[model samples]
Target: MKDDNLGDSLEYTTGAEAMGDGLSRARTSFGKQPVLGILALVASMALSIGIIGLLDAELFATWVTFFVVICVPVHIVISMAWELNYPSFSRKLKQPLKGAFFMALMLLVAAAIAVTVHYAQPIHAGPPTPFVLMYVIFCVLVTFWFVIVWNCWPLSSLLDNRLLLGLGILAVAYGGGYGLFTLLFDFDAMSAAPFYSAAMDPGGAFPAFHVLAYSVTTVSVVFFCLLFDFWPITLFPILRAQPLMGLVSTIYILGLSAAVYWMGVEWLDMEPVKLMVNVSIGFLFGSLIPLIMFEGKLFGNLRQPWKGIAQCAVAVIAAVTLPSIYWELAPLVSGPLNSGAPGYQYEFWMASALLAMTFPIMVVVGKFLDFWPLRFAPIR
Candidate 1:
């Protein structure tokens, strides 16, 4: 009896040790290859773009409108779901019910905006049955893609007490800026020839509001989730510092805007001044506005006065030189896509490709650059 009991205890200990080792190995394997993960994400996005591009012009426009107005908000809800269920930090909201409420509120607001815009320009001719069926298929495909590839783990740790604050800031900055600009200027005339308009219009299939919705949704998602939550870059030791991270993040976003402008000019035939304005708006929404609103929460912990000052300086520098840098690099990266040949007609495809090209650039910056002022300071 004593020998049997001893044997049983030994077997349990051995099994437990094996399980622990297996879990450790699994974590190391998944956690180490961020570049691989990013590449996979890029491929998935490209595939989705390709698939979505197959729809006819009108159907395509409608699908994109739906995606922009509905799917984008759904993505936000999904992110909030992750936060509620699988929070990675101590500061996150603990109550699932509260998280659900926030999610519901966000969706409701987004839906309200979408419904208002859609009704404002009601389609007198309802879409064909085939078109509706295709649109449903496209939505299904996009949802699967988002769930499988874009539902990143980094978002689980991205929030803090400042999330609601950040959301408020985002709303005021975007809403106020857009409203003020439209009030003061003829946006339709100014933006008529812009790349965003061309892409969103896609043979003049959508109204100006549809274009606006698409641009806002795409920019918000790309900034808040994709770029901000870029794991490989965010994990870099040098970039873990507050000010340095802020600077690099700002530069990266500007670079992306430049790339978009380049594509707009080379592929979509957008006017330079118009593209400039668009890029400026993008920079405002994606970088400057968020920075002011989040109070550097997007860049992680500051915990120092000097860090705040440095971040401000970087922001100013980025704002001043953004145009010059955009013009300089626009041609270099835009050349390949131009090639004196017609590029992808669909806007989503071009946008996806441009985004993919930027990923490698981001990886290079994250891997090689050491911008931290104190070389010996421990990485956050």
Candidate 2:
């Protein structure tokens, strides 16, 4: 009787294994999470609205930005944790939520640095220190909340492996790009070489110019890298949800940069151009680059040599020409108008035309300099 029972149990276990495999194959082809999990996301947004409504007007806006910069990831983590720990939600929700939670954590560290600076400087007129502190605290709370969510929603075996690989690749690419740029180029290599050197010396340059230029440039670089990498981890949902998602995403990014710029400049009295450039740089580096990278190919084998060459060409041209564009345009709009207001008008149009012309220049440059070993001279 004991031997018969053992054989029966083994047969049941084998059957369950076969069933699991079949379900997973179906999920892979369909590529969506359980519908209920998406509803939970809507509920989370409603909760977020309640929280924001409690804050004062100025604080409310900051709260909204905090939610945007921080909370979405928290929502994902919460869902993941729920599904992981309880094993109740559809397994599809678990992986993306987990990835989002991790990303939120990374952004938290970056935000902490930003907040720290916000407090240290007497930059804003009305004492923005309190607002910055609240933002930081909220971010930390959200991170922990997501940790709980991650505990709840355990991912399927397939998703767990994929998430790990995706994160690893992103980390390697970011560090590698930053390291390469720092090592290869000196302050003299950039158009804003003087500004770069000034930033390092005993006393930094004026706050406005520094903030504007550095912020935008940093943003620009990040986004540009992201675009080139073509990470479908972010792209999959995007492609599915909206037909014009790319344009929408680009506009959203650019608008966010502009708003951040306006705040740094108009509110905090930073130089407009400097703030714009820095914000642009940050967007370019963080999101734009990654978007460009991931746009065309989904699950395609990575291209080599030419990919790196194209990135180099774009980066170099952008760094040199963008500043020149800014420098040439500034005087026309702001400088005292003499008899040649018309000439200034012409210069404005000419600069715009030149900036537009750089697209073809990029193509030409790519052809000539795309090869390795500094054919004549490197882009820097």
Candidate 3:
């Protein structure tokens, strides 16, 4: 949100209006009807589990890369540009049509990105980790700067068309993300890997996962804090104002995410990659379900610190519980899970499945489907 220079246009919404955005349509639908919401989400997630379970380790990574390269960023675009208002076509359509049309839109965009990555071969490295981190983690990191932190300011006033505005944000995402990626991440940490090299896997300023972990943690903060009615940050109007708000929030959160990630890496006995894949992502999935799917109704009456505290507990619960579930399902889905390189490739595959594959499925079900069958289901 900028100064009064920004206003709500048909193309996009800006300023404080962007605050708690996407909540009304998706949240109210689910918050008011939790049972229905759970039904829809359970159905969607089961399908996701089945699909991931089906793919072998190597194929799963490829599938994760393709799906994430397209879907994760596409969903972010939907949130930032459309504010989760899919099928922005002038007229209305029915259930599957509306959902199908929206999905068609997603697939089309995914196709475009897929084509680019196919031809460009941005990261011709050994695996999709570098590329995926750049595209999904780093790219979206910058996108978060504009869409969430910066409130599309400057651009919000400058660009009138949503498509143009979205494109503008994406330009910054890729461009800034490139610089940030090279600056913050390094794949040479994987020096043990066969693909290690100076050009493609050339190490960055920090170990790749250092930043990756930070970036992922940054995302978690977005869920429990800014998205939670811009809490704590909202307490200070001066800080909440654009530019400064974005600047301060971004820096402080980066500091916090780094600390937390490093601490876990140093203290925990578990494999860092496995811990990151299971716990970090598990928390993220945990955060998404309550916010986007359950619509934060579990503690609707609570205020920020307490509410956020409750949600944090919920996130932890999910981080601990869900991964165990996904692990149990993993063997069934893909026969056996791989631990790491030299044969095992389950970690990255698992990450992609969680972030790229399963995340999109959940969003499509909750947001695009509008909680469909359950929403339409009859009350006894």
TM-score of each: 0.34, 0.28, 0.83
Single out the weakest 10-residue window by summed lDDT for candidate 2: 2-11
Compared with the true structure, what per-residue lDDT tens digits does model 1 show for residues 173-247?
Answer: 334433432333222432534222322222333433334323333343333323234334566888744445445
Model 2 TM-score (2 dp): 0.28
Comparison by TM-score, 2 against 3, better one: 3
Model 3 per-residue lDDT tens digits across residues 1-380: 22422111211222113444333332344334467547666786788887776666666666456655566666666654665443355124555565666677788877776566545554554445454445555676566556766677777766666677767776777667767776777776577775455556535687776567667677766555543556666789788676777788777677766666767777765555655676667777777666656655678688877877876787678667766767667767777666854434667656666677777887777666655655544444
Candidate 2 or 3, higher lDDT? Answer: 3
**Which number leads on lDDT?**
3
Off by over 4 Å in 1: 1-31, 69-112, 120-174, 184-270, 273-349, 352-380
lDDT of each: 0.34, 0.32, 0.62
Residue 146, candidate 1: C-alpha displacement in angstroms: 24
Instruction: Give the range where candidate 3 is weakest over 10 consecutive residues by summed lDDT.
Output: 6-15
Note the clash tally of each candidate: 0, 76, 3
